[model samples]
Target chain A: MKLLSIKFTNIEEEWKYEKIELFDLTLLVGVSGVGKTQILKSIHTLKEIAGGQSVNGIKWELEFQTLKGNKYLWLGEFETINSANELNPEFFIELGDLKEPKIISEQIFLNDKIIIDRNSEKFQFNGNEMPKLNSTESAIHILKEEHLIKDIYENFNLIILRDHTFKIVDLFDLNQYRIEKLKNQFKTFEEIKKSDLNTFHKLVLIYDVSKSAFEEIKSRFIEVFPQVENIRVAHNVINEHSNFDLETSLIQIKEKNVQKWIPHHKMSSGMFRTLLHTAEMYLWNEGTVILIDEFENGLGLNCIDVLTEDLIYENNKIQFIATSHHPYIINKIPYDYWKIVTRKGGIIKAFDAKDFDLGKSHHDRFMNLINHPFYKQGIS
Target chain B: MNLYFILKGEKTEVLLYPKWINYIIPHYKQVFLEKDVIENNFYIFSGGGIPSIYNHTINAIKNINDNPVFDKLIVCLDGEDIGIEERLQEIKKHIENSKVVLNPKCKIEFVIQNICIETWFLGNRKIVKKVPEGLMLREFIAHYNVNTNDPEELKKI
Candidate 1:
């Protein structure tokens, strides 16, 4: 499924009043401090909230449409955005114009026929007066009994949509450690322990074939270092119980490896960032929305053109919302995808590059002018 | 002379060098491709990727890269206490089949000796500390700002 458009409010300078369109392959362009990453962060926030997960201090209104005729609206008034005492003001999704979404046609279902739709919670349509919904009778549950919405929860899962369609897939991206952690959370450790030889031996015979398929997909993207040929992933080990836990992360390998005493930090900064791009591509394969804060950290002008042609233009699956001050990454993508985020007062304002211009794409012209804007302030 | 300028830039300029030499262009030249793109005579670190486009550095380094017009290739570098010529040795020797050295030449190469005098004249100023007395002129060149690409920026002795 494709995303049509997004409405964002109360976000970073580049994301406020953000109305962004998507392409089969969208390129976010701009130099550093322009706020491309902020847009990505906001969208990821909205998707996370939709999945019944919430982050504090995220005060605002946002909405999105799916290929299915479902319009999900999330609105809330929290006492405090950060603390656990934070309350959800409202949560509901409008299913497609599927008739009788709730069993309120003057009947609640009994086996098959509707017994009563009366006393349903807050009825409104074509101007019907407010009526109390029966406390004992949940109209939503009645609709579910009739198979009105088959995949209700799965369809409403914002994370699943972001991961499956936009981010790609999450299951394939998980390694052995994550796989075991998810299994251990099952409570029955004896049944789920894959690392144990006894468990692995029998399971290997039964599901070893399917396991190979998973490994085959995982192995395709891994880069092997020539020195020790050791494979290293970049994601930090996150404790789920901890306040900041993430399921996926990026990985990197040396650009050129040989046997020599070398400090880990001494590698060229530009080549080191290649690891981030590679891991990001893998997540794109799994459908993950990546928000890169600085896209041009260690890069030089020498590798600019290849970075555009190879990374930005080549990858089609993942959605990248990154902020960069370097023209190398920005010029590769089109102006429509490039957003200009300017900070006015204390608020952030994000705009499409093309909005500031007519007809032509903003790639070259914006790069020339905005690449170095002589700000209203005297000092750069 | 096959003269090349390894410019640090994103801007474009016209060639102020000769045309007979072969030019090996580096990437990021900002020009589109044309015929006769690869040249054996010129080795350019910043090729615009297109063969037909004219480049000052590309034309300068052509044919003359091997000729003896330069007499000696004098290396100018910053005095950040970092060994500049030592780092450039591999690259320099690879380009021209001669050993590269950092030395004093009073005419066009006087930038080094000038740096020597400048350090003795202005050292111990505010944040700048003076180098050891008689810190050979070649070593003093490291104390001055030397433009890697623009020869005109060099202190003309």
Candidate 2:
């Protein structure tokens, strides 16, 4: 699913973010405390609510396009209740405090036709009244099994949040049982290629399943870190001193003119991050929207250049919404893909780079951007 | 002709010159880096500021001598706290002390912005309104009146 635009407001807190448009590759650029990460968090919160979680006092309107070219406009608000007044008398006596927020109003439109509409007094699906529907969950979650709603619900599953600072242990956690299951499930390379496996599982067997794919990832990794001579994923015995056998598959890399192979845990964070990102880009499923925060945290100069080039030049159908304060990243990305965020008190806004007439002249665009009043003051 | 520029005032001139260049010479494209230069392209390098700009100019001359692709070199700096002739002589003396030879095919030129480049910017009459709203801008206009006089001749307060 691709988010086209969003308008979010927290009524209780009096904080509101103006409607911001999104592109396939949107990069949020601004000074700190401008609510760039809050925008991403709001989207994740909506995803959680779509998965049947209750959150309070947030009014949101999201317009997204599904993989099958179906456009949807979903808007709703969660009702917030006072803890002392709204709780059940018995529960209030025991707990002393309780506050609950539930979905109070929801409207879903598909291609401009109303698929579901619900209010405090009325609940309707396809213009049919149903008074027995639940208010604690989103209509999309309640009707997820319906044929029309299944794709929309599944699209929320494709929104993946990637934090570069946190390592995903599952990608490198290769135990004996998991390895054995993978081996038994796909005995041949063709079967491995035909199976619908996740990125972590596919990556664990990449070298064995397809040599060319492994070589491609290796070459890309080498472009960023030239010291790496070779890389492989193989079974390595962890408990050599123990009587009972304990083994796991670890990603190992050999340096130029060196006999020792460095395992994944022993490698530097920057090197490991570059390798993981390279592999994920190659193996991630199509039609996926990846949200990344602080994109340049652990990246070196060479890694930044290679990754930025891959993001711009690669033909993968993945959409990226990333935030960065690095000047190299800001200058490297085209100005048209930038959304300059600014804030004042409870109001936040995002403006397109084109609105400031950036990139229209052949000047130093980065220098011009830094000197701009909107960027300097962080308000427009 | 491919032109190379070494500018003073690390921040403002580095930003404003290309815009003015593009406005005056719309046909010539500005190259951000020297390696991207081609025919009819201009590239700029900031010298950081005054005394350092003299050495930067000599370094740029050495680079231009080694790469003969550039046909012209323009050194732009403020004529601050000194006469325009003295600033020009100071730059020449630096070049002579460095013992660097200029490329015979490429011509060298200097543009000394009198007082400062910001004064030149203020000379644009269209930017400020006749009846200004801001107090600081109104006071600045009343002190020098750039709208009616040559801003370069305005005295420092």
Candidate 3:
């Protein structure tokens, strides 16, 4: 299932024509705070809702097309009663509206069939009467409770908004983890192994030389870092207790120096960050969407080029939407991939580089255009 | 569609070329790719000064030849120290030696700011009267009206 497009207003404004059309790999480029991360977070809200988490004040209109040629549309309106009450006391006092977030209107359709449609009080599932749903609960979540609507709910969800399909790797968050881990080896490998493997660990596992499948990855790492002759990953038993109940496996890495294996906590921060980020590229199983913010956080110029080129030309499965403030990151990618987001009169506008005849040597020109004082002004 | 201008100086030359273009052709908006691409479909880039500009422009053309986003090319420089014709010939010779083949249909043009873009600005009587005589073009733009609303109007004087 792939997301075809997403249409939503960020701050309670009615969405008239604002929509982001997504390709297999879409890139969002702009200065800081032009709603790039906000756009990403809005998409993440769908995943949260899918996980039974409620989202408030999200005016969303999303469309998805499956590999099987089925199309699904989810139209939802979330209203925050408290803000309304505070600003307009007369309206909320007369209605006695609750201060929490509630679904004002919700609709989900598969092709032309109305799977679920909810008004303020009652909702219909496949044209059948559903129980009186709380305004706060999503129609998908509420419908999931009914056995009759369970299949429909699951189908709609799996095809359109599977939680696993969406992944956001914010390097800033990873940096915090790296900083804590660097200062103190508080967590053992057993903890990381027991915990759900994040993209970082999933990537690091590729170099777990214990696995025969990772030989290619090991060689690639060697090519990049010649100083490292070989890398070995293992879960060492650092602590043990009676009945093996307290045995802990610490993730350890040994370099080619023929010395004692060191904990991953002791490894260089740059290498750890680099390996974690790039290792995801070697894994063949493509995610539905991968959102990377600050893609150039720890990567060198050469590494950035490799990753950028790979994402732009080679990968076909994962739909990638990345944000970058680095000029090199923005310049390396082709102009057609650029979504020059700018704000004017407090409205964010995204201009597709393909829409403009940005000259034959646009990459060179683009480098200059972005630095121009009026670059923040929406496309003329 | 994309245009490149390899100027032989710093900000003074950078700011002056656009003013000169506006002075010559007022409606032709200076579209830097770093900003927005206007409807006229022209882009201008200044790749530093002197040998850097020469090498950078050549490499940029070659890179474009490999990828080819820019169909039209323009290389501009000041004929301050070097002879304008000699500089153009040297650039042409360098391009001929390289692997790049300029598109036959591409409108490739070369312009030299005679004595430099500063000369044109200092040509204005108002500028000459306002400033001490015999200051460099860079000094003239720098000393007075550095952030003028009408940069091109300096040419009228």
Candidate 4:
């Protein structure tokens, strides 16, 4: 599903995000504490709610186009209720009463026609009243079996959130038992090719399946780090002291003028991040919405250019909603993709770079943007 | 000698400086690429304006330190409301706080235009007509004839 726009509000937190229009590539540019990351988190929250998780005090209106070319508008609110009211208030208060959040109201529209109309008490699906449904879960999840709602529910799986602050654990560092299980899973090349694996695993699998595809990824990686002469994924005997050797798949890079190949664990964080991003761009399924918070985090100056170029030129079908404070990343990306976020108290708003008449002049757009009152003052 | 410029006005100065530099210093060719700097080459970078220019100056200092090939680092900015001395102090303060020391080999220079660079344009009597067509321009010229008086003393009006 391709997101067109979104409006999110958290009553408890007193935070509200105004309707922010989206594009194929939306770079959320803002000062810190303006709720740029919160916008991404809100989308992820909707995905979680659609997947049957109950979250409190959130009201969201999301407009997206499905893979089948159907435009869907999903709006809903979840209210938190004090559990103490249902039981003995005094007794429950002493035990630290839990607050149960339930769906208060929800409506789904397909091309302006309402598919589901719901309230706290009851709901109507396709103009027909349905039996009593659970208030804690979304109709999209509960009625996932229904033909109209099934695709919408499944589309939530396409929304992927990536936070680069945390280091991605090396696959080789996994416990021996888990590594053995992965080894067993990868025994059949055909199975490995067909199975749904993470980007790193898929990076290794791509090498076994298609050399040309692997070469494409390696060449892209080399563009960022020219020192890397070669990159390969192979089964390395990590532990060979005992009678039975513990083998695990490893991605190793051979650098120029370096005799030994550097394994994944030995690779710098920047190098590994660049390689993983390259693999993700090449390998992720089409129509996926990858929300990357802090796109430049842990990335070196060299990696920023190639990765930004790849993100803009490559992944034509995939959508990227990334946030960044780095000037290099901002300048590298054309102003057409920028969504300058601003905030006043709890209300956050995002304005397109075009709205401010940026990039129209001959001067550097990044310089112009930074000088503008909207960017410097964080309000328009 | 490789010259590096960090200008204030994002549009006018950035567009005009290269032409002025090329005309004034014919031997020093303009290098479009940052890494391709050789002898007798120059590069121009815009720093937006005012406060933003301070950070840009700091960044340029860092760049100059890293690439010692640059023989001169010239910063051209509008004095604006702060005047030349105040603007120089602001830039110096930012550089000092950033702790990005410039290469000792490279000579540093500042060209602070009083009021703005546009005021200097008025100083050229050939460009400023004796009887200006626009009422605002005519009144401005009548009050303070830039051709006669020093344009640097022009106030904010």
Best by DockQ: 3
Restricting to chain A, the TM-score for each candidate equals 0.48, 0.87, 0.74, 0.88
TM-score of each: 0.40, 0.68, 0.64, 0.68
Q: What is the DockQ of each candidate?
A: 0.03, 0.04, 0.15, 0.04
Per-residue lDDT for B1 in model 3?
Answer: 47
Looking at candidate 3 chain A, the ten consecutive residues that score lowest on lDDT are A159-168
Query: Model 1 chain A: which ten-residue window has the lowest total lDDT?
Result: A160-169
**Candidate 3 residue-wise lDDT at A269:** 52
Provide fnat values for all models in the order shown: 0.00, 0.00, 0.15, 0.04
Candidate topping lDDT: 4
Candidate 3 chain B, poorest ten consecutive residues by summed lDDT:
B148-157
- Candidate 3 deviant stretches above 4 angstroms: A12-17, A66-69, A82-98, A145-196, A200-210, A236-263, A268-270, A282-287, A326-336, A362-380, B1-4, B7-17, B23-43, B47-56, B59-157
Lowest-scoring 10 consecutive residues by lDDT in candidate 2 chain B? B30-39
Write the residue-wise lDDT of candidate 1 on B13-130 in tens digits.
1131112122433322221111112332221222231121113222323322333232222222222222344434433444344333222221122012222223332443443334
At residue A329, candidate 2 shows an lDDT of 86
Query: How well is each residue in A1-380 modelled by candidate 3, as lDDT tens digits?
Result: 56778877645442222678876766777767677766666777775664456565667788876545577788887774436434665444644553557788889888867888888877888887767767677776766766644543454343221122222223222333442342243244333333334544543444332254456655665666666666555433223443432222233455676577765456555555445445545553433466677777767775676678778876676667777777677778776777767665446666676786544442354555553544544433
TM-score of chain B of 2: 0.86
Runs in model 4 lying further than 4 Å from the true structure: A81-96, A173-196, A236-247, A358-362, B1-157
Per-candidate Cα RMSD to the true structure, in Å, reads 15.6, 11.6, 9.4, 15.5
Model 1: DockQ score: 0.03
Model 1 alpha-carbon drift over 4 Å, by segment: A1-3, A11-18, A22-37, A53-63, A67-288, A297-317, A358-366, A371-380, B1-157
- lDDT (C-alpha, whole model) for all candidates: 0.36, 0.80, 0.59, 0.82
Superpose all Cα atoms of candidate 1 onto the true structure and report the RMSD in Å to 1 decimal.
15.6
